[model samples]
Target chain A: MNKPTVLIIDDEPQIRKLLEINLSSKGYAVRHAESGKEGLLLASSHFPDAILLDLGLPDMSGHEVLRQLREWYSRAIVILSVQNGEADIVNALENGANDYLTKPFRVGELLARLRSAIRHSDASTVVQTVETGQLEIDLMARVVRRAGEIQKLTSTEYNLLALLARNEGRVLTHQFLLKEVWGISFQSETQYLRVFIAQIRKKIEDDPNRPVHIITESGVGYRFQ
Target chain B: MAAVKLHPFWQFLIGTASIALLAMVCYALGDSMDQWAVALILLAAVSVLAVLFDIIPVLAAALLSALLLNIFFIDPIPDYKIRDTESALLFFIYLFIALVNAVLTNRLRKQEKKIRDREEKEKTIKLYNTLLNSLSHELKTPIATIIGSIDTLKEIDPEIGSQQRMELLAEMEIAGNRLNKQVENLMNMSRLETGTLKLKRDWCDVNELIFLVIQKLPATDTIRIRFEPDESLPLVKLDGGLIETAVYALVHNATRYTPKQTPIEIVTTYNKENNLLIDVLDSGLGIPETEISHVFEKFYRLPNSGTGGSGLGLSIAKGFVEAHGGTVCVANQAQGGALFRIVLPVEISRLHV
Candidate 1:
């Protein structure tokens, strides 16, 4: 079997070096590009299995790159950004990037995120059940269970849980979630999403205050692990 | 114009005296001028006083002039008596003129004060803009360092010497750390200014917090940081993300101010009052006595300190801590160095774990 390949687009040499050394050691072929233009050209010619993009590129913004890539490319594209830059991360995710990692992240964390992003994008099998930390959500049956206990959830609650479960490790933004669970007109009703999420957390999380199954990305959105 | 402002009392004394002198002049020139004409001249004098003095003194002058007109320049001079119907009417008319002058002048003065207030507000907005411009300007040094180093590395034709290569990389790391610090400070300041900082209060373990923040600090081996968590410490409910940034700024400042080979210690304890007290103690030359008060002020750099910082770190720390209903204090330790403390009020239930 051929080894999976990864492409990195970043202006900082140190970040590119870190990604290259770490990704290469994990048995994946790695390619590097220093600017947005070169990254787009190399991505077309090489068609790497996964792409790591930095938002602060010199040639073009990371949002612009993601927008152009989404027109044709359909593989996993994980964004890299500085910490507390929630707006940019949300924009990238909304622009069809699968996942994101803040800079200075540990190598293990990056590898884990890359693995999840690549797996979900190429997932041909329709998942019926999602399980994390003893919380099992059966999408096909519209059921939720904690350990062996069946959780009774409202119809709205079930839909929200099912949506987050299906997109497992990806950060779904507030606007996207509101539109998907509610209608397009409800995109700006973030308070509704918050109330519903609190209810869902009480049902699924062991300690709803410190949730593990459904984690909040603060101002961005939620990530179901 | 050089503003020769008079005290309100002095203005009142001068205005009333000037009205009295005008009344005396009219009394002396009584046969030459009509009583009604005298009233007109007195009203004009009161209006001039309103233009030059404060409202209180101007209003007082108007009333005094009317009283003087009645007492000294009336139909029955030196007596509070009206002799003829026309003269009584002229005296009342003179009094009415003074009252009208005060009212109109009072209204005009209030309008002028309102305009001045609006101008002050615009000045404040302009100052904020200047602050923002200077902040962006402060970012240029680190950016230049990063670009200049990269440019040098790129121009190398042959295999770069390993020692020089490592130095360049180290320089870039330091510059990147400085750049990131400025960006973090800028974001936190904007968040505070815009009121967009929403506290996400979750259970926070002090042990894990210390580990995470230390790991996140710029890669450095020079200054040693030591902390041992209290085994019985319970999880405090607060915004872990914000508190982490606050603590990072404090410790980061210590790293910059303290010299090499010195150690920085962080001690977290649950106080008797049920507040979480965090003390970051550093062994170095303590902050100057004069600068202690101004340390938390935004962009207030110490006059003699040659450190390169945006001076927003401490202020942001104080702001975040305060947002959580907490207080931050700094004091020069008696032994040496500075002691920084953060006290956060937490729920009573969080204490027993």
Candidate 2:
């Protein structure tokens, strides 16, 4: 079996070398690019399982690369950035990145994140299914089953449900969920999130009045249990 | 002889008329014994008004009165004008005296105004010079550190141990962050001095802000940082970034001042007195009472202290805290350390987060 491959795109040569050595030592194929243009070319040519992208680049922005990747690829895209503001994180995630990592991160933490990303992206179709209590989710097939009955969901609703389900135990901030489901622009219209969440609860929860899975984080956003 | 209070033009007219009258009186009384009395009265009255009203041009009026009295009140009457060669010579001499007095008084007024304007300009220039000196000294230290660190990183090889590499990288990161923060402080100071950093109030968790501040301090891992907040510390409406930056500056200052092996303590507490206090106490060399006031002034360092700093840390911290409706103060602790205290008013809980 071929080892999983990861691509790292950063302007700093030292950072690129550090990531390259660390990931290569962990038995993953690692390719490095110094600019966004080179990174996008390598990403398309190699079609790696995941890409660690830096937001600030010399040639083009990290956002542009994320947009192009999302157009053709469904691979795991993780943003490696120095900008840790909630808005920027949400924006990057909205632009089709699977996750975001702030700079000066520990090598151990980076490795764990890369492992998690690669594992998720390489999952077989049958194992990609998520089951929590009576809810059943077939991610690849874009179908949901509850109490032995199939539940119909629009593409948006399905994506939102899948995101919440993926991060079930963590508090998903409004920015986090907005960027994940609707992309960056949808962050401002949080009311849309509220309406969709309500519709989702109506479809999934036995009583929308007393939600069991999706919980609102008040001013922050929502969390799934 | 009436009190000679008059405007310049009026004084000129009155002086001319009075001189003519004096001359006529002298001519009419040429053989009488009261000829000098009219001339003396006119001189004394106009001179008194000239000094009293700051209208020293009245001196010119007095001189004109004397000239007319000499010409017409003495031996030059009926014609009421100069006829003899000696009388014409005296009239010319009195006219020269009046012109000299007017020129002297005008020169004095111009000199007084010039002195006043020069003093004002000197005061403004002094203030600007002080500000520039402080700003440049504060800016230079951090920039130098950043440049030095970058140069060092470039010289090191790539195959160093993970620990050594990490330390160097962390140092570089610290220097970069310090440069970023110093620039931010300069910008904020400019904004504050220009009155542009308006507060944008929002619901914020004070605990979360404290956590963020801790995250910024990598040195805190070595030092024992103790953060203890009140159980009922409610959500506060405040400018989060400004407060965070202020707290970070305070922490960075504390860490820098404290000894390497000593433990630094950061405590957060709130009281019913309507204030939230953050105290960063360090077991380091305490500042003398003489230097406490100067600590918050930009670029003013203690005498003979070799601790390298841009010296904008405390001043910027103070400015940012004050901008957020808070106050910052420093004092030598009782136990041989420095204690920096920041007090921010507990904002009214607006929106629940």
Candidate 3:
């Protein structure tokens, strides 16, 4: 198997240096750029497997860079930013970024997110079934089973769960989820999402209050683990 | 000017009504009171309104008084139009004096307000300077230590012993962690002070929120933080990020202030009013009653407390909680411990999709 290439676009020299050391030691090829324009140029020539794009770029807007790369590139583009605002995170995700991690992130967490992003992007084939813990979701059958027993779920509930399960370990924002499960007009109806999520948690989670399979990403979004 | 903010409509009503009352009083003393005296009194009333109330109300009062004077005080008995030259001259002159008084007093009040606003702005700048000075010290210490340790490591790269190298590396990590914490606190404080701290609310499970907060805190050998979530707690809508930071601050404070091997407990429950309640209890020495109130104040540290924090944590916590229209308070427990409680009015989700 070939080693995956990871490109990091960050203006801060120390952060770039530390990330290079941390990532290279884990046997991944790391390329870096200090500005958004340079990053986009290098990305075209390098065709890296995964890109770490910083939101606060020096030359142009990082969001603009992400959008430009996404126009042609079909690989994972994880965002690295100092902005921890929910709106910022949601905006990045909505603009086609695969994952978002705030700066000063733990090395272990950054590596994990990178691994998940690369792993998901590498799988060209469609996923038919998603499994985590004792919960099993069979996409073709449109059936959810808990502990080998078929758990009854409404059609809408099944669609919502399957969508979340299909993108396991990646956060799906409320707007995205509502638009996908419901419609674009239902994007602002977060109350409906809340009610459905609570119902799903009750049916699947051992403790609905302390859910582990379906993780809430603060006020930004939700992720199925 | 009175501190009480009377509405502009009420001020206009009161000012106009007072002028009518004065005219009626002059009518009761019909033969004795002079029309000139009534005009003088009305001009004085307009000036008083300008000084005490807003410009719009004062302007209205001035116009109303002029009309009142023309209708009753003029020589032509109860005539809307002034016929004689003396009465007409008196009307124009009275109108002129009343308008001038209103304009002058209004300008004076505006200038006074401008001076007051500038003074307040100066005070804010002074406070910002104090915060910056304190932050410099807090931020520089960790950075200095990190640079010093890293430099020493670089110079003695080959000669340093394994244990010594490990110690230096650990020291660097500690300094780096402290630096990161201070930077985070400074960013949060800036967001709060600039009025940019907006809550991004969503449906969240409080138990999970507390669990995540605990997972984020640095692990220590001396104390252990425990959580006992209410089993029947519903998924409530809230800004999970803000509430997490608030609860984290309270629990982190307990770990820093208490003795080693102390057990910290976090309990969550909803009251009858459907407000989500979170309590962080510590079995350490309780806070002094006098210090409790000041604990949540910005840059307020306990007199006997050791130095580690920039004294912004609790204040930031209070700010975040208050942004949610919530309340956070502290009380010493009966069993010689301190309890920090946060109460937030949250919408409980009970629907089944």
Query: A-chain TM-score per prediction?
Result: 0.96, 0.62, 0.94
Q: Which pairs of residues collide in candidate 3?
A: none
Cα error, residue B148 of model 3, in Å, equals 1.9
Report the lDDT tens digits of candidate 2 across residue range B1-353: 22334676776666566556655665665666343455455555554444333444466566667656664554545345667776666556555554555455545656766888899999778757866775565556666766766676677656566686667667666666756665666676776678877775555556656756775677545345667544356566676667777787777777776666677777777678878787888888988888888888776667876545666667778887898778999989888888889998866553332
Residue A179, candidate 3: C-alpha displacement in angstroms: 4.8
In the range A66-141, model 1's lDDT, one tens digit per residue, is 8988899999999999888777888888889999999877688899889889888896968889988788998988
Clashes of 3: 0
Which sections of candidate 1 miss by over 4 Å? A1-82, A85-98, A103-112, A119-225, B1-137, B219-223, B348-353
Write one digit per residue (lDDT tens) for candidate 3, span B1-353: 74237987898789888878878888788878788998988888887778788877888888889998898879877888989899999999998988888888878878888999999999889878768876888888888888888898889788889899999888888888888888888889888999988777776767767878887777672239877766578878888888898898898888889997789999998889989899999998898998888889887778878877878999999999898889999999998899999999888878423
By DockQ, the best candidate is: 3
lDDT by residue (tens digit), candidate 1, B1-353: 11138998899899999998998899898688777777889999997887777778877888888777777767677777778888788777767767777777767877877888899999789757757665766678778888988987899825679788889889888888777777777888989989998886755655556655776675572238888767577667777778888898889889888887699999999888889988999998998898899888877767766747777888899999999999999999999999999999975333332
Provide the lowest-lDDT 10-residue window in model 3 chain B: B214-223
TM-score of 3: 0.78
RMSD values for the candidates in order, in angstroms, are 11.1, 13.6, 5.4
Off by over 4 Å in 2: A83-87, A121-174, A177-225, B1-202, B211-226, B239-241, B258-275, B281-286, B304-308, B323-325, B331-339, B345-347, B350-353
Candidate 2: residue pairs that collide: A94-A179, B23-B72, B23-B73, B26-B73
Compute the DockQ of candidate 1: 0.07
lDDT of 3 by residue, A25-97 (tens): 9999999999999999999999999999999987899899999999999898899877455677789899999
Error of 1 at B262 (Å): 1.9
